[model samples]
Target: MTKTVQSRALSLAPGASRREMLNLTGAAALASAIKLAFPSGAMAQGTGPEVKGTRLGYIALTDSAPLIIAKEKGFYAKHGVPDMEIAKQASWGATRDNMALGAKANGIDGGHILRPKTHLYTTGKVMQNSQPLPMYTLLNLNEDGQAISVSNEYRDLNVQKDSSPLKQAFERKKAAGKELTAAMTFPGGTHDLWIRYWLAAGGIDPDTDIKVIVVPPPQMVANMKVGTMDCFCVGEPWNEQLVNQNIGYSALTTGELWFRHPEKILGMRADWVDANPKATQAILMAVMEAQMWCEKMENRQELSEIVGRRQWFNVPVADLNKRLQGDINYGNGREVKGTNLYMKFWGEGGATSYPWKSLDTWFVTENIRWGKFDPKIDIKALVDKTNRADLWREAAKTLGVPGAPTADSRGVETFFDGTKFDPAAPLDYLKALKIKRVA
Candidate 1:
């Protein structure tokens, strides 16, 4: 029997009693190989490429589920990979730096990293001195999962809420002249972008209007309770944790803003992909398939265990499961409507995994507006650089994933606010914008 078939059989093997593997870390072993005569041609293709070794970097967050899932599931081996080791980084900054200067530099190769960090480094926005190697664009992880949580004190302001809580909340603070502080994971990540976007959407000037700080996800709650921040926009567990502990109340969820916005992407340096194209495609195929498995409600507990494991997120199963299911508990006696904001295990289709060109355009425009990059580069060129739907199509085709992605010549779409985002002609969209850049 071929190795691919052997690997697939192992991955399909039924789980040992659920009691034996509560977290679903590893499925039962594959059946002993039965002597099945294979045709000579059977060994030709469909056997995934050879993978030597990869040093993938990931921060401990619920959204890191995809990487964990890929590892836990035999998706890697099934795709004809040799071995892989996941390196847990201290922080996002450390992760990006490690990729820029680690085994990839002197050892094996650059490991896995966050999508935006890769983009910033490539464009020389975050680090001024170094020229970053571009990373392969793969599947997106979370969409619309960011949450802006506030200390329970906001309830005391008697803020009247209508469509826009942020605006009303800001008005309440202004009427009372109360100072507020909010936090994000990074200056340009979804946490920060969502927090600031929500603030601006409500007519609050994110610059002088309020103080925004950079706090890691694990530290958000502690920082808030310690008076370091009045509120925060961060990924799951932290948001739910605050309410679970009665530390803060959630003001709004980013998922509520647009339902589906790309949050995370599987990232690898361009040099690595160029060096190991087949191996890279194999990893992509495995994760994309794993993502499909994760979208199902039945796989919830299994996924929770894989991502919640001490090695990955180091968080308790109870904490991860709550937000994974979209059930949000806002402080005491309040629960935000449970919604699938995390999109933890999205497949190729639906609201979860498609590479939305318009979405990419919005992210780039915001990056420009925030002064992260000079926006002087041609938006079209940058969009092409940041998004690789063409590469995605090749990987998807290899995996037999249906509905190949097609770039819209018509460009990206316009949002509800009457702001048009054209992926192809980003410069035109930038010129027509009504908002002011940070300068």
Candidate 2:
């Protein structure tokens, strides 16, 4: 059977595309042929992924490493998806827009996305189109790599992890009729949430205390250099780029706000997954392999090089390497030597990749806390529908990893400010926050 499948696959025209092959021989036959052609140790005998070419989108952030790595290192091809396309989006908004376009429109099948944004997309609260675009998270991309950076002017203000020092500066600026401007990658996104939480933790209301603006990740340094914004929160290379340019200092890493907090996620449309379960599993399997590869210490150098390429992140490899290896220089004469707060792709105990429903609950509740959505919504049900842990388990199992665990919740999550968030009582957690817009 293997020989027959191999012969059929080899018989196709050399330059024929996967879609063309599918049109010629149907999806099931193409999947079988491709499966036989590129059999991995974990490949099981079953209906393989549909042989449709997937255009996976990603922003120019370091957390996008897994998707780029999978495409660059042939992991996607090794898992019987040879026609995967890794697209570089301009910003998170563009990424979301493309995902909403779906595969038929030549948009993305999926990509790295903010967890809560997926909820917003599905609920039709935010989008280019009003129709609800139901989505699900297959796995988390990375954790602990995002940071808040302030201009060099704040270096002497004694601003460290807390924003207390900036509060006085903010008041002076406001008195002078110049409202201090703060920037994040997206409104109600992870960076926005992180910056808001950091500011509110320091008694600064994000909405009332300052002017918050949206800036793309790659353009963060340029905007900061021109003194357009006082401070900004975004994912790596940009934060590290600011330090490299000597224009700003890393005031705080997001990991310092909430240890091992969820950052980017592998989000896909639910209807896409439902229609193409095998293809979805194949994509997840490839990413799972890439995640394990990215977690290794020895592979950091190569990983950095691959992601820092002109086509991918378009940044210097050195800037990307520093954070990945945990050798962080805060650009304020404060050096963190060998910190464990480096970006984690796949840690022990299934911490990084597993799409814990609890994290989703926190994201949704925070959206409510920030007044992006109403508090009357069912948080648990939203999490259950948006987070597809069952799909992650299926992919992990296909990779020869352990089966799905008994529970989906990661239990109570604690923050650096000593605030505790129990997923079971999200409203209680919201009520505990002193500065919030939620009624």
Candidate 3:
């Protein structure tokens, strides 16, 4: 079978795409037959995964390293999903549209996505014509490492951690008849919520004091360079790139807003996971191993180089390396070295990678605070349906991951602004927020 498979693969056209090769060889589909022959999460001796591959999407952010590293380091191939395609998405909105299309329609099965997106897509809040695209939160890709950056126009104001200085600066800009804009990657994404929380904590009403807009992660620095936005929140290495280019200064990493806050997640279509359970587990195991690789301090430089290659992020290694290693130059005269605010891929005992249901509850509640979800929406039901922490645990067990959490909830979370969000009482958390759009 190996010889035949290799011969058939070598027989493909010279310039055949990965998708075309998979189709012609029936490698992905044939692996599904293997699934029936074996059992879910149980591979037959010397056999490949349920499917050879599936398309996944990602933006050029550094948090997407796990998926990229998984493909780059042969982790995916090792797990029998050798044909995994990690495609670059143009923007978060594009990611959403492609996700709604699904892999069967030339779209991605899943990839690095915002935590709130699963809830948004599942409920059809951000889908086309309110058509729900059921998705599952398989893994928390990384924690913290996202930052809010200010345009160089406000350099003298010296904003860092606290966003209050921006409140007056923005008010002055607005009173002068100039539009004050704050940009985030997506409407209900981590960036949007982070910037909103930062602004609101500093007494600036995001809805009233500033005009919020959607800017793709890569376009953020360019927009700020052109004076299109006052500040923007997004994941590294864009924030690092903006500082390197002298276009903006970092106010604070999202970790400062809420220490070790969850960011991007590995999300997939529920239908795809249901149809290819073993393949799903294969992909998860591969990504989990990659996350462990990314977490090692010694591999930080090498990790940055691989992701910064032209085929991947096309960014300079200098822009990614420093921040990835916890050395941050805020570009506002406030620099910190060896800080604990770096991006975390796998915390103590795999804490960073585990998909915590409580984190999902916080994201959903924040969306509700901003009026993205109806106040009457059942937050618990939404979290239970969208967050697939059970699958994460199963994959971890198979991988022999040590110290995976046994409980679904991580308990109460406290942010930098002295506000606490108890996952058990999401409504009370919402009630404590003073700048909410909800009644």
Candidate 4:
């Protein structure tokens, strides 16, 4: 059998590189033989991964579920990553800082992060050190779980989906010589973009009309209770906590803003991926399997129980289960039963996990629209550099999942406000926005 296998391998590759030769051979059997022979000296000459320990970072949001589940449920270990370390980051800023530190210095190798921040770091717009950190988004973590929660003061004003009432209140506050403040998790991040778009859609300028503040996700509820912010946008449990505490009400979910909108992503430093491609693929496969588990409706209650532990989110299991089960209470006596727009881990048609480059392009355009980055920068090049759809496709193919219909674009996406974003012409879409900071 050994001689026959050798002959087959040689016939397939008369003259090939060591890696290619191993690929032509039966890689699984050859890998086992190489490990037995070498012990710890060398790896099999194959396309198989170099198994190594990885330190992953995650913030305390419900969308961080995939990474958390991957670690807690032994998916990482089952996929050849037995020494994976899951670190809970204090905030998104801290996650980025740890990722910048890299894995060698006890920092994170990768993280669940904001999609736009990947572009920001790649363009050197975020961390302005002499050396910029280039990052790649391997996959989107989850979609449409975030929401805009306003203070109880707006309840009587009839502020639900439409922010026009909130805008009027802002104007009234300004006329009274007071400031109306709105908060997001990070500047130029996903929450920031959502709140800005929501405000701007109602004819309220996010920059000049109101003050925007930055608060961490875990701190959002406490800050809102103390009247530090009028309205804030963030992920689950925190928003529901506000409603539970009777301090605020959810005006609109992000899903209501843009259905299945891309949110947190699985991000890694570009250099790490370049040096450890196989390890990166291994990590993605584990996370993707965990994502498939998270998408199961029957598993959500158990998921909430697991993620709600003190070691993880530290929130009540009930709060996490509320949104996880798709039961939304607006905290204004309006309840939506069995809604389809809850947080989606892996949506039908591979929508949630696939890192669409066009989505990254849209984020870059929004960043340019908000003056976070220069409009003259090459949007396509930036998207190509940061969004690692190719890597995701490879991982999916290895896992036997269906590939995305297209590599770069997800076609035209329409928002709730009847705004259509054409990925092919991002600048034109930006030009059409009536209430934007850019000219």
1-439: candidate 2 lDDT, tens digit per residue: 4565557676655455776566534567777666545554125434556664488888898898899889888999888888989888988888878888876798887888876778988898878766788998889888889899999978898476788889988899889987588999887889999999999999898899998899989999999898889999999988888999999999888898998999999999898889888888889988888998999989999998998888787789988999888888889888887998789998774568888888999999999999988889988888888888998887887777754454788899998789999999999999999999875
Estimated TM-score for each candidate: 0.79, 0.89, 0.90, 0.90
Error of 4 at 248 (Å): 0.7
lDDT of 2: 0.85
Measured with C-alpha atoms, the lDDT of residue 306 in candidate 3 is: 98
Task: Note the clash tally of each candidate.
Answer: 4, 1, 1, 0
> Per-prediction RMSD in angstroms?
10.6, 6.5, 7.8, 6.3
For model 4, the local distance difference test gives 0.85
In the range 178-203, model 4's lDDT, one tens digit per residue, is 87889999889999999999998888
lDDT of 1 by residue, 1-439 (tens): 4565555444432433444323333333222221122232234333546455587776777677766777788777777664766777766667666767646464324443444664676776665375665755555665655577877666664222122455566667757977767788877776777776666655666777678777767888888777667668877777877877777777766666555667877767777777677787777777777777777777877887877777787777777776677776655466655566555446444235555555666677777877776767565566567565666677777777666556534245544344556665666765664444743
Most lDDT-accurate candidate: 3
Better of 1 and 2 by TM-score: 2
Task: Tell me how far the alpha carbon of residue 423 in candidate 1 is from the true structure, in angstroms, after superposition.
Answer: 3.9
Score residue 134 of candidate 2 by CA lDDT. 91
> Which digits, one per residue and each the tens of the lDDT, describe model 3 over residues 279-335?
999999999999999999999999999999999899999999999989999996778
How much is the lDDT of residue 407 in candidate 2?
Answer: 72
Model 1 CA lDDT for position 115: 48
